[model samples]
Target: MLDNLPLLLNGFSLAVSPYNIMLMMVGVFLGILVGVLPGLGAPNGVTLLMPLTFGMNPVSAIILLTSMYWGALYGGSTTSILFNIPGEPSSVATTFDGHPMAKAGRATEALTTAFVASGFGALFGVVVVTILSSWATRFALRFSPVEYFSVFMLAFGSFVAFGGGSPIKALVSLGLGFSWASIGMDTVSGSMRLTYGFNELSRGINLLVVVIGLYGIAELCQTMQASPGTVQPVATRLSPREVLRAVLAMPRYWIALLRSACIGVWMGITPGGPTAATFMSYGVGRRFSKAGARFGTGEPQGLVSSETADQAAGSAAMLPMLALGLPSSATAAVLLGGLMIWGLTPGPALFAERPDFVWGLIASMYVSNAVCVIMALTTVPLFAAVLRAPFNITGPLIVIVCLVGAWTVGSNRTDIAMVLAFGAVGYFMSRLDYPVAPLVLAMVLGDRTEDAFRQSMILAKGSIWIFWSNPLAGTIITVALLCFALPGFTALWRLARRQFLPPPVASGR
Candidate 1:
């Protein structure tokens, strides 16, 4: 870690240049707007602005883009808290309790806590990226096809097993996502399986379109049906005393903060990304907290858990992309494309050959985290006022944004239709109390899982034992199986204990 300090200093010098600093500020502002608006997220924001950076130096362009990513992560929680609408997929878990807190007249406290936690998480993740990235890159080199498959399997199993819903429903949702992900043309066989003769379907469904419909359109539908107003007006200001109390309470959950950051780093280095990390951290917080029974009922721990993990994972994802040339998330994939366009190849050689660009990107993340957190905290009351507007006004605006975003992403009329269909599906799923997150996560992981499994099978001549042929792969597969069975085993153990133990007799007073 210390050996990299000179490179980090050099990177900081580049990032702090006047032109780069101005670009970073602009990117942060735009990212917040994109994140606050429904259907626009980090990937879309970066993609929209990428062409503008083609004429700039590689370091400057990266500084701008990564700053935007940090701002988006911070901005997403605002909509989730005020409107029960997750502007980004990573913020979905925030809505579970953030909206509740806002309705209960604790909007200021909730927003403050989210920003503080996000800052802490981002700082930790950036430090990891700076110091331990080389080690992480080396570790990732040990992964082969079977090992990669096991890692993805572990993510899927952990999410479904601990998703806090009906196991059957979670499995069904995941299966449906897998089905949707499989609709695209197969790269290995060069044949389509589920396109059903539709040329558009041959390209498969876009996860971005699905996210917009499921969260944006479906939320508007539910808000309209459940109440006339989208959200109730509440006190959106925090006093000095109230702010101090909230800040003081944070230290009590230090264990949760540390644990969530670790989980986020692991997920980011692997393929789980911030969405999965947020849910996993929330689940862990719910199960481990003393107030476990009150998890989703305006719990502050829920906000901290989700926000910390989301920010940490979002920042940490850049590590693998920078060090190993592997994109851990969709946004990272877009950034990877940008890197190639700029004639920069990401790998171990990146550190030796282009330390300036790599360190500049890392330094920018640290700077952006501080800037965005302060910006988000100051603007909380302003955004909270949007909740006072009538749903009748906000609802149609949301639908229009969704339509425009979907249409413009690929310029395809079929994507607009797909959004509407998904919106209806999301509504019904919510009405049935089914978890929607697993479906989205499964869609993200499904294609990668299939590719890894197929590659492993081909290498092993169709022998399943290849997953256990090496110690590392075997251990990963073992852990994945355990994660899958843990919930069932715990249930069966409880049942057995109940059946064998005698009930306590009530004594008459």
Candidate 2:
């Protein structure tokens, strides 16, 4: 790590150039706009900018794309906090407490906490990448199909065990998500399994469309149902002072911050992705925090956990993309393609050959993230003001935004209808006390998990022992099993105490 210091310093010098700094600002602003709008997430935003980068230098192009990515991440939390909509899939967990906090008239604090925590997580991830680039490349190479499957299972198990809801309900949600994920043609068989003769279903449901309906449209439905007429604005005070206070209070949750950053880094390096990292971190934080019981009720720790994990995973993902030619997240995948388009190859050789480019990108991460925090902070008042708008106006605007966003996903009208249908499902699910997090998690990762499992099985020739044949895979599977059984074990322990141990005696005196 120390040997790379001079290179890192050189990278910083390159990143801080006036031209690169201007690109960072432009990328961040555009990214924030994309993130604030539902469905136009980081992946889409990066893809949209690819064509424009052809004329730019590789370093400049990457700086623009990565800076935009960081901005979008911060921007996504904006809508999640002020409204119940998640601008990005990863921001879903942020909505759990962020929206509630906004409803309680603490929008400024929620936004501040989210942006700051995200910045911290991103910096932490960059530090990890700086220190562990070579080590991470070697570690990532050891993962086989079996290990990948184990990792996915661990994510699901964490949700079931640590998610503060009925395990049965979480399972049911997971089942639905997996079922939805399986709708498209099977890759191996090339057979349509769930289309039911509908040509539109052949393409499969777009996850973004589903998310728009489930969170954006669903929230709209709930809002309209709860209040028929114009609803009064939520009382909120947005100021630099409030933001400062939130920043100052962050140290109190250092435990959550560190734990979530670790989870994010692990998930990023291991293919769990930013979306999964956010949900898993939220679940783990809920289970471990002193105020665990209050997680969903406007808890700052929940926001911190989810946001921190999200940025951490996103940043750490760059390591694998740069070192191993593996993109852990969709945005990273797009960026990887951009690298190829620029006539650069990924892997260990690229690092040695293009130390300036590699280290410059790393240094840009630090500079851009710091810039993003400041830029996002300055925009809080503007975003928070949206909450002060009467529901009569904002309600229609939100619905329009949801429909528009859904329509853009595939340029198919079918997605708009799907969003509406999912909206109804989301509304009813919320009324029924079902957790949406598991469903989203399943949908995002379900297809990949299935593919890994199938590949593992094929390699094993139908034997189940492949998962245990290696120490790493075996340990991961074992941990997953423990997570899966934790809730049941807790229930049994409580039951045993009720049956054998005496209740607290009434102390009359």
Candidate 3:
């Protein structure tokens, strides 16, 4: 970690250039707009902008996207506090206390607390990434095809076990992603696999097109269906004095802040995603804080707990994506796709081959966090006004953007139709309560998973036992199996306990 300081410094020099800084500001502003608007979150915003990055340098493209993400996160809190709406799904927990505080005329305090806490959490997560990424990359250097396969299984298993959704639904999503990924010619054999002689599918489905459909178009449809008339934002003025007061008072809740940040880091690394991290941190805060009883009644700590965890998890998730080719969230999955599009492979080799890119991205996170905090605090009113735009106007515009983005991917008309098809699929999947992140992750990693498994099989002469041929591979596979089985085991245990335990006698009212 100490040895990497020089690289980090060099990264700062690269990130702080005039061009990069301009991009950062622009990305953050657009991201805030995306977050403030109904139906557009960080993932959707990033997906929408991906096409524009095709002509950009890979490093610049990544910095722009990541800065947008941080800004979107901060923007989400604005709506949660002022409009009783969560602009981003991860900000849902913020609404509990944030809205109440706004209603009580503490909007400025709630907004300030949320942004500052989020900044702190993001910085904490970035620090952890800086220290852990090098070690993780080194550890991954020892992995072979068998180990890689096991690692992929572990990622899939962890998603199923801890994804905070139904295991069957998650598995089904994975299957769908893998099926879509298999569409087109096989790279190793140079033979068609899933294309049913459709000339359009010979090149396979584009990841960008799918993402535009799933996140952009699909979300617009849902938003239109669930339009809630005009939003009346809370009236509040943020003064420098109030901002300073909120920042100073944050130290009082240091324990909660630290605890939530740690939870965010752990969840981000393990694929629980920021949405889960926020709720988990909020729940834990409510359970343990002395003001637990007042949690939903305008407690400032509630905002801190949820907002901090949301940003922390978001920042920490980059580690797995960069070091091990594992994306812990939907946005990370999209970024992984961007890396591949730029001819960059994510893994230990990436660090060795392109330390500049890796460290530059890491350093940019620090700079972006500070930029987001300042932007969010100063521009709350501007973003709040944006929410007043009717969905009828914004909805159609979003659809056009999605279509245009899809069309540009290969200038193929078929891509537009595919986007519509996937849009329907995504909408229905959301209605059925199916998790989309797992599917997205699977799609991004599916081809690699298959290649690794095939290589492992070849090495073992078609023996299935090859996964367990060595201690490292065996251990990883074992852990993956345990992760996959954990939910079932817990359910069975609960069922057994319910059947065997005696019921308590009813008390008289």
Candidate 4:
């Protein structure tokens, strides 16, 4: 233990170095900024700068990337609380009460709750990753291709179950994303797909361009469809009395933190990201709160629960990368890619070879968490000021940034076109009531899903039975199948309930 402490301490040294600490601060700052912006997220933020990080040292590169990751998550709650728009999917839960808190003139209190909870959750996640990483890796390694494929299936199934929209639309969006994911050359046949016959076709769609197009440009265009307006952020300063009370006032909130942390830890290791964790934590918070009656309407607990889970999930996602050598989320994937770019091989060997790097990252989580809170507390008023900007100005700027971000990804004009195409598609699909989450999830998982299926077939010597042959694989498949059937059952139940209950007459009507 003492020996390990020295290694961890060494990691702390690097993490706290002026450059690294500054990077982490920047990451938090960016996280907050991006989180405040609608339609942008950690994935897009990371991919937006692939070219820059490609040449940097792994350690410094990681510090910058990780900090950005943290910052993006931090910024998300600002949108949720101020405008009722979730800056990221993970912030969806925040909408439950964060917006209302602003509406009720308790915006400062809500922001404070969100910041503190995020720090607490991040701290918890760091501890989990530090102590249980080896165990987590061992468990992850037990999954074979068949099992892995089933897990993907489960993720999709669960997505549809909880999407709260039309299943066909969700499937369509997901299929589109998966099709896009297939754009690169096929591994076995080396055949190009969906490339439209350009030389750039061989490289496939750049995800950064896709994200910029789908979220940023399309979102801007959609915003143009409406008359623009200015939104002044609700301004309220918390007094020392309120601060002391808010800090120690809630016992129930800690329970919410625990549950949110569980959601974060579970999803971080799986395909789930901060978005899923946010949604799950939100639902759970609503279900568990006795004050549920006040939910979605200025309840401090709502912001705490959603924001806490968001940061926790983001932080814990580092475990699979470090311990199992698997990159579970987009940011983690890029972090893995960055490690490769720096000539470092990750896996069990990485810990043995660069204990300081691994331990230092762990220590930095604590530092970053503290930094995020301190910064947020001092600057909540400033963030709220962004809401004061005229939508006409901000919308066009968002469009330009999206376009530039897309074009810059590969320094290719083709990427800009892709962004426009995706943005148009996103606009149409969104209007048609398609749930976009499945599509984004599919794009992220598509290649991996295909690889898993193919590997199982190869290992089984072309036997389709390989997908369901092993007991673990078979069970996972069976369970996933059951999970997939849930939406239909849910629909039927809702219908039954509606038929049985008569509508109450409105007082005015």
> By lDDT, who's the top model here?
3
Candidate 3 off by > 4 Å: 501-509
Instruction: Show the lowest summed lDDT stretch of 10 residues, model 3.
Output: 500-509
Ranking by TM-score: 3, 4, 1, 2
* Candidate 3: tens digits of C-alpha lDDT, residues 1-509: 89789989988998889999999999999888888877677877887788789799988999999999898898889988998888888999999999999999888899999999999999999999999988999888998989989988998898888778789899999999998898998988999988888888889888778877787777777877775565677886788898898889999999989999999999888767899899999999999988788999999998889999999999999998999888888888888998998899999999999988999999999998999999998999787766777777778887787788788778889999999999999998888888888888889889999999999989999999998889999998999999899999999998897779865764577
- Superposed Cα deviation of residue 9, candidate 1 (Å): 4.5
Winner of 2 and 4 under lDDT: 2
| Clashing residue pair totals per candidate (backbone < 3 A) | 0, 0, 0, 10
lDDT of each: 0.78, 0.83, 0.89, 0.73
Against the true structure, candidate 1 reaches a TM-score of: 0.76
Residue-wise lDDT of candidate 2 within 1-509, one digit each (tens)? 68778888999998889999999999998788768754356765675566578688999999999999999999899878876767787999999999999898888899899999999999999999998875655665677879878877886787787666787787898899899989988877899979999999999887767767776677566667774543333444578788889999999999999999999999888756798899999999999989778999999999999999999999999997887565666577668767876899777777778988899999999999999999988876665564445667766766776677666656898988998899889888877878776777677667768988999999999999999999999998999889889989999999999889877985577
Clashing pairs for model 3 are none
Over 4 Å off in model 1, which ranges? Answer: 6-113, 237-310, 317-361, 494-509
Model 1 error, position 29 (Å): 4.1
Per-residue CA lDDT of candidate 1, range 1-509, in tens?
78778878877888888888788888887777667764456766665667667788999999888888777777788888877878787899998888899898888778878888888888889998888876765776677778878877776676666666676787788898889878888868988889888898988887767766676677668767876653444566767676667777788767777888888887787656788899999999899877667889998888888989998998888887776565665577667767877899776677767878888888888887888887777766766665566657766876776788777657899989998999899888977977776677667667777998999999999999999999988988888888778778988998897788854764467
| Candidate 2, superposed: residue stretches over 4 Å from native | 2-118, 225-364, 502-509
**Pairs of colliding residues, candidate 1:** none
Compared with the true structure, what per-residue lDDT tens digits does model 4 show for residues 359-473? 7778888788888887766666676676566766766676776767776667788787888888888888776788666776677668778988888888998987776887877
Cα distance off (Å), candidate 2, residue 284: 12
C-alpha lDDT of residue 309 in model 3 = 97
| Model 2 pairs in collision | none
